[model samples]
Target: MPDPFSLSVIVPVWREAPGIESSLKALASIREAGHQVIVVDAGSDDGTAVLAGPLCDRVLVSERGRGAQMNAGAAAAGGNLLLFLHADTRLPADAVTQLETFMTSRSAWGRFDVRLSGRRALFRVIAWFMNQRSRLTGVCTGDQAMFVRRDAFEALGGFRAQPLMEDVEFSRRLCLVSRPYCIHSPVITDSRRWEKLGPWRTIFLMWRLRWRYWRGESPESLAQAYRSDVRNA
Candidate 1:
């Protein structure tokens, strides 16, 4: 028999009030399906916590950083399976069932493919490349909705305290233990970032950052460059 386990969906948010309601509502089915949802807010003054309070199973406040917030959520979570999700991402209807099935296999870590939400054709190409590159490199991004067994996550020491590329670093460490189950069913994520910033420019910026990271660049410096680029874009 497969290892029976519960799931906890952890969402790390900072100033995401504009979209938090819809995102939490999207997880209603998952909550109803008996999984737990935890929203870790990084001191958002936009009522993100109040708005999410009624929707999710738990609402936590933490220091302002995605990695920190997610770590706090994971520490407080009681489920055997921990799913790190972004505020703007929505899982597919069958996500829980799929994860449950995959947990029966030898793989202990995984992420779903991602589809950017937009009508632009460029978004399709970006999504394709993102999924294919992740499959080839075994490095998953936060947008991909990374999931892991709680025991495995704890053993790996959770996400590193970094401002950027935490997902990539965590995936690298995870691959040391087991190859990730790259689920082909895609999760839908907001494309506003790409829409606000030029799609191709954003893609190139990400690629550049990844290359720099691979070359042993400091995350703080990369994070500063990323914020500056986004602000100036």
Candidate 2:
């Protein structure tokens, strides 16, 4: 058993009106246990903050970017361990217990494997590849629900205020200090984006963006391209 520590789950959301309620509801057990839950809304007009306000310990309004919103949430968190969760991601029932145990014994920072919530067989393959790639590179994506020791996060200066690939950038910096735990238990994430964009197209675009990013392409340019592709898709 590892030393006990409180957890603060921070969820950065934008226009998540459709899923925010259910996501919060799913986290009821953790909240009931007196763990903190903070939802940072990115100026969503869809009542995202309103719905999330009563469910979470705190609701904050921030600039309309995932990275910015997440940093704001982390700034307001009270726990020693910070878990950054996606609005559409559903954590396992034992996530809180698992995290408490893992954090005490494992690396200072870690991420769970992701399971895409869809019936398509390709979704499984995509998740498998994603998990394997992350393991190989010691990099975890946002959808995988990354967590870190609060002191380490502050020392690393939180996440970079980039329009895209903030998780990638953060992971790169974090791995310089320690390798991620890479828990095998999975968090299920909604596959709406992949479904809407066509899985193959999304996969190709992601690979292209990652390749360009690795080659030193500007994040602003990559973000613009990504947004354009999403809109067109």
Candidate 3:
């Protein structure tokens, strides 16, 4: 008999060829344990799909956006549960066990705590605040590796068709169903963005963006501003 509580981990990528293989390889054990790993590429020219093909169960080509790519992955998944993972992030070793506990629970959705892949003390401080803020506000970021039951995901209609803050928007909607079942075991996410802008500058930029987003700014505008800032940084 098939496992009723199987998980499908979806990774959305765009030009992530440099680390795509390693990222998918990390999920090998999950695949071996009867879960599914789907990599959705948003029209990468760097052969990301080719590199990811053998490591995961399926490699899909989708529209050029994280939200669209993730939605495509969710649509193709065969598991009862769906996990939206980033290509630059790696789940903890005990993620399968943590997911099993979530599968047996009544939670509609969940996210893992996130730790930046930097050895600096400031990175730890940043991660601490991020976890605390998520716990307090019931809001989650993509770096956290969000997961939900496939039914709930389908009901919510997957991610919004936005370039940024899709995770925040989805989390707000998911909150209407149930508070996130946050696991303490942290997922390690790349800190290259922070490193690019310097930690404090990145934090302030993000806070400003979120504040504007909350003030009813459009995601397209926010994404443009983010790109400009990152380029200037």
Candidate 4:
């Protein structure tokens, strides 16, 4: 018999009331499949928690940070597999079937390919590079919808508290355990940030940040720079 397993998708959000309901509603099929969906709210006063409550298995309150919030959700997750998804990203239609195959694979962690929800040609170009880079480096961003086996995640102690590049940091450590099983089906991620900053500017900004991070810059300083860049834009 195949190894029976369950999945828990943990989404961390803050003040995302406008889109929380829609995001959670998309996961209703997973919930009906006996999987779990947990939403972690970082004290969103915008009723984000309230909007997400009925849609998920649990709505948890946690410290204000993506890494911290995800850690809290992971702590409460009961499934053998855990998926850390972004609020503005939507998984592929066959995500559950893809994951079932992953559960039987020897790989301990994986991530989906990503596409931006923008009509621009540049958006496709950007996603192409993002996926290609991840494939070559064995590192992934949160937009890719990172997932891992529960035991593997626990052994690594989950995500560390960081203001930025938490996903990058975690992916680095995760790569040391086992290379990720790259899923070809893409997740559609919101392109609002890119469109807000202009695609070219956003691309350059990300390249600069990742270069700085590779050069041993502190995440706090990088985070401050990111906020400044976004604010100035």
- Model 1 TM-score relative to the real fold: 0.98
User: What tens-digit string does per-residue lDDT give for candidate 3 at 12-113?
Assistant: 999999999899989999999999999999889999999999899999999998899999999999999999999999999999999998887899999999
* Ranking 1 against 2 by TM-score, winner: 1
CA error at residue 71 for candidate 2, angstroms: 0.8
| C-alpha local distance difference test of each model | 0.93, 0.93, 0.94, 0.95
Candidate 1: clashing pairs of residues: none
> Model 4 off-target regions past 4 Å?
1-3
Clashes found in each candidate (C-alpha, N, C closer than 3 A): 0, 0, 0, 0
Ranking by TM-score: 4, 3, 1, 2
In order of lDDT, best first, we have: 4, 3, 1, 2
Worst 10 residues of 4 by lDDT: 1-10
TM-score of each: 0.98, 0.97, 0.98, 0.98
User: Candidate 3 — which pairs collide?
Assistant: none
Q: Across residues 1-233, which tens digit of lDDT does each residue of candidate 4 receive?
A: 85478999999999999999999999999999999999999999999999998999999999999999999999999999999999999999999999999988899899999999999998999999999999999998999999999999999999989999999999999999999998899999999999999999999999999999999999999999999999999
Could you give me the TM-score of model 4 versus the true structure?
0.98
Error of 3 at 125 (Å): 0.4
Which residue runs of candidate 1 sit more than 4 Å off their true CA positions? 1-3
Model 2 quality (TM-score): 0.97
